[model samples]
Target: MNEKNFEYLRDQVKYTGFGEGLESELKEKMQQQEPSFSLSHNAHYGTDTATVTLNFKKSDQSDMYFFNSYKVDLQKDNSKESLEQTFYINKGSNITMKEAYNLMEGRAVNKDLTSKEGQVYNSWVQMDFKEADSNGNFKLNQYHQNYGYDLEAALSKHPIKELDTAKFKDDLMDSLKKGNVQSVTFMKDGQEVKHYIEANPQFKTIKAYDGNLKRIDNRQTKDEKQSEGQNTSMKQENKRQNQSAEEDGPAAPQEAKKRKKKQFNSM
Candidate 1:
């Protein structure tokens, strides 16, 4: 969506409030009978009108729930001209403006957001913080306040997938043995959040945690592999060319030198 004159409230809703809500409502509307979900929307008019929408859903089928919120704007009294900003929320946890953009930029979750069951909880804001460069709009903190639960423990308690179970065990065991993990992530209710691995001495990539395997980008993996194969073939062809040139013996070099001398003498 697009807007004409209002930007403040849109910024608050898009970068700060929650994820997109208009589509979320449609999703709930479509999936209403499958499960009962709620989409509550509020519009705040400060110099202009801003619509904020939030959605919630539950699926015990997978022992999980999902929540998302978003915002839209139709300013200058031109109802046809609408500007929309959307965000996703897991359970009640939300992504800060920076985290959202960072995720878009392909950043990985490096913080853990879990505590041992029955353990005292700590605030997420207590950790180190960073920010992103403004596209001349607003300055967004690179990290946000953690709002979810301990990811490792929760996953161990309720695995997302069968494969996730094996990965989860290794993550926990690595934590116990190595003593520190820079970050770990988990979902609560329906939202995704992060936690810092307290025993972090070396940073582990998500793929490594998932078994030190290479993560394949489904969209480009095949193309990438083909490109590598082509590069190897090109290298082999170049090697053959160089070997053939050497095999042509010193006669070619002497002839080339003679040609060079003739050219210089003619000059």
Candidate 2:
């Protein structure tokens, strides 16, 4: 990539808030004891920012982020924006966020974090759209701020690994767009009751609850569960009716007698 392009992306990155608060205290205490390493990188592009926080676990492991946590703000302004990408670090889920930063430049974010210790953790990403309205058109997959950085064109000549975020933001965005078997929400009156209603994608969710506060299932899409409702009970009911004739009489006997009479006449 050209120097201008590189500088544009570099400006979005800041090592600020590094070794702050608990990290500072822990590192200070560790220095008195043994030694440790920790990592924190908060990348900002446009109005959105991805905050990285790696808590300390072992000594001399300070350079690496342990028990990682990542938070990606959909909008920079906090009080108004509610949609965010968040994930907690767990066993075998720890990975790097280098790819995630690239994604902010219109690249892809990896799904796991890698450490010098070779430990892994699941990057369980959740896209919180609780504050989004039915008319909201915020797309998570697309890069919100390119900042004159033509990352797509640059990758044609350079290796993508150079910009790998090694994060899970892309996976979460893909899953949301594909409408995976993820949790949706419902509401009661305006209280927002998060119970029941797989709320199939058959319809667009306007409000979680109606004016009366009842959970509204506008039911715009039909899924497998809806198909399951179409049982063979109708056919079974026909057979039962034949054995115990209803007011309309035995349907099978009438057809059977007609068949026998037709055979005798032919003979």
Candidate 3:
């Protein structure tokens, strides 16, 4: 959230004086989680766990400042019910913000999301993170941090999709692979998230990617095909007209000249 605003102290929890090199240590810890995992820290009160609400980026920019709201649980007991989902990620593991964003953008998961009651299309997602103690109980890390992301920003930069495993979508796949950027997304519990990229083709279009071999639908794709066919027909017709005009060009001029000469001789 807003590092400058009161959020830094929303729970009235000061950034506890972690030892020097804590940031480096944390960064190293984060690297361990790389290639796929997340570690979470919570704010703990006496016997209660502090809470926070993190909103997805409602707009284009970073709303972590105000619009996106979140809580930091401070439950000493990793097993206690406190803010957000509590779980302990193994040591030497942490998730990057970009990887976290890819997870939500369908970088990893291709399962279609079913609409839940009261959940609108643009509704917020209650993402969870965790850190564990020696007792195997989930606890917050020393410095509570979550892999929060701005949904829109994530989508714009790296939009992922579940493409049909069929050959038809090869074009789109090629586009996605163009930058040669290797991206991998993982869930907190070590579940794999799989998805595909999109590249729209004209002469033939892809409709859906849900079924095996991508069930082909003639609905929207037909529109593109129609446009392509129309353009091709027009191009051929123009080519024929130009050829006819060129073939008759010399004859027409010669005939006109002969007619003028006959008129002059008769006069």
- The order of the candidates by lDDT, greatest first, is 1, 2, 3
Estimated TM-score for each candidate: 0.23, 0.24, 0.25
Give lDDT tens digits, candidate 2, residues 1-267.
123422322222222223233444444533443233344556554566666544433424333223335544433455464434433454443223433333333323324444458754323222223343354522333222222323233222211121234353344234333323223332222233232221112122221233344554444212222332233343454566555555457576776556557755874
Model 3 worst lDDT run, 10 consecutive residues? 87-96
User: lDDT (0-100) at residue 43 of candidate 2?
Assistant: 53
lDDT of 3 by residue, 1-267 (tens): 234433332322222211132333334433343332222333333444443333222223532222222223333454644333322111222222222232222222111122335322221222323444564433322111123333222322321222223353344443332211233221212233433222222212222332233433445334433554555565675566556657778675565556557745874
Model 2 TM-score on a 0 to 1 scale? 0.24
C-alpha lDDT (0 to 100) for residue 193 of candidate 2: 28
Q: After superposition on all CA atoms, how large is the RMSD of candidate 1?
A: 22.1
lDDT of 2 at 74: 38
As a whole number from 0 to 100, the lDDT of residue 122 in candidate 1 is: 29
Higher-lDDT candidate of 1 and 2: 1
Off by over 4 Å in 2: 1-29, 32-40, 58-79, 82-86, 90-95, 98-267
Best by lDDT: 1
